[model samples]
Target: MSDLNRWMQKHNLCPENILYLYRSDRKTVLHRMDGGEAALYAPMHGVLSVLPEDQFLNISKGIAVNRSQIVNIGNDGVYTMSDGRTFQGRKRGLSSHRRLRMEIGLSDTKPRPMSMSLLEKCSLLDDMPLAFCVIELVFNEDGHGVDFIFRYCNAEMANIEGVPVEEMLDRSFYKVFPNGDKKWLVSYADVALNGTKHTLHDYSPEVDKYLTIHCYQPEPGYCACVLQANEP
Candidate 1:
């Protein structure tokens, strides 16, 4: 059960080690739980777009907090973290967070109990019968495709590839499938960069399976695949 803390620590404070994100001078400062801070060139919205919403609460137009760790919101507009840290919050944000928590099925009357985050349930797609994966394309300085990162894969995908899910996520795709029969860069690149949908009917020598593979862009710079095995 990997929680947000471990995930953010490994991800280098890109997400949860950050208890508070403050926007200053058009730059976002990530105030980490370990008492360190880092500056991000981008705005808070850009960073939050890729993160899970379960823990984030916008304390202001330019400030967000990890509300899951917050234990109390005082009438004086101060929020108390479970670790006894306190931050001055805005009234606009306090009301907004209460409504959001209730809408999202979290209790608004008390502190949040410790629980597994599960990457905000993004991988819940694991229940699908066919193999599914999300690959993020990597490019060189010249904007040419060099490789791709395996951002996620369902259990069915792990089974089809004969690799563990943990072994694939955030890893190089070619490293996992060293014996790839055909070069996939062209197809995947076009899909990730141009939002094109492509399908291929081919066999994977690595897994010894013939399949109809459908590739599409779920978001910019990312390709999602649904592999239906013909040999099944």
Candidate 2:
């Protein structure tokens, strides 16, 4: 069976109860309610396309949040999940908000709730000036690292890549840039698996730019990177 199919069978992700399918670099995770608490299934990619459209909505570039999972929407463009974690909406003027409200069948003038958390505050990174991405390490069955996936990237990183952020979501690093150094993949895997932080000054032939990257693991199996583009 394909990895996507395997994931669906293991998670019992039926159309009836799943709240959303969130994409993070290499995986598409299922978010659902289990016994009044939010449960996230294991991450797998390529499953979103098969889900029923009437039940899911693509809220942001890489995030397809389930309509039932939404508990509140704030005037400040914060979406509060049933589990209390918040995700900021993409900034494309007021129309984005209008579109979201329309998709969820919500009135535009609804009152904004006053609940916000540190995760909501950290959503500001989406608009931050620096280039940032959350990367996940891909491993083989034998536990050897092969490539890195771009789970989440900010607008700055999209600008730096000269591509739409959507194109980078869930894409393997080597597939995106066929000429990228393989050594960087090993470095990323090391940081992700071992939880070591690293800083490197390297030149990217793909974008034809030099970059100073600070990479660290925010959790096991995932690494977050902040980079500055330098002139060659």
Which is the leading candidate under TM-score?
Answer: 2
**Which of the numbered candidates is closest to the native, going by highest lDDT?**
1
Q: What is the lDDT of every predicted structure here?
A: 0.67, 0.64
Candidate 2 accuracy as TM-score: 0.46
Model 1 segments more than 4 A misplaced: 1-121, 140-145
**How many backbone overlaps does candidate 2 show?**
4
lDDT of 1 by residue, 1-232 (tens): 2454354455488555667777888888777765677775776886676567877877767878886555445444555443344566666546665554455443343222222343334467887888998887653332222467787788888778888989998878778888875357667766865688999888878788887889998776677899887874
lDDT of 2 at 204: 78
Q: Candidate 2 residues 161-186, lDDT tens each? A: 77688899778777788787765764
**Which runs in model 2 stand beyond 4 Å of their true positions?**
1-122, 140-145
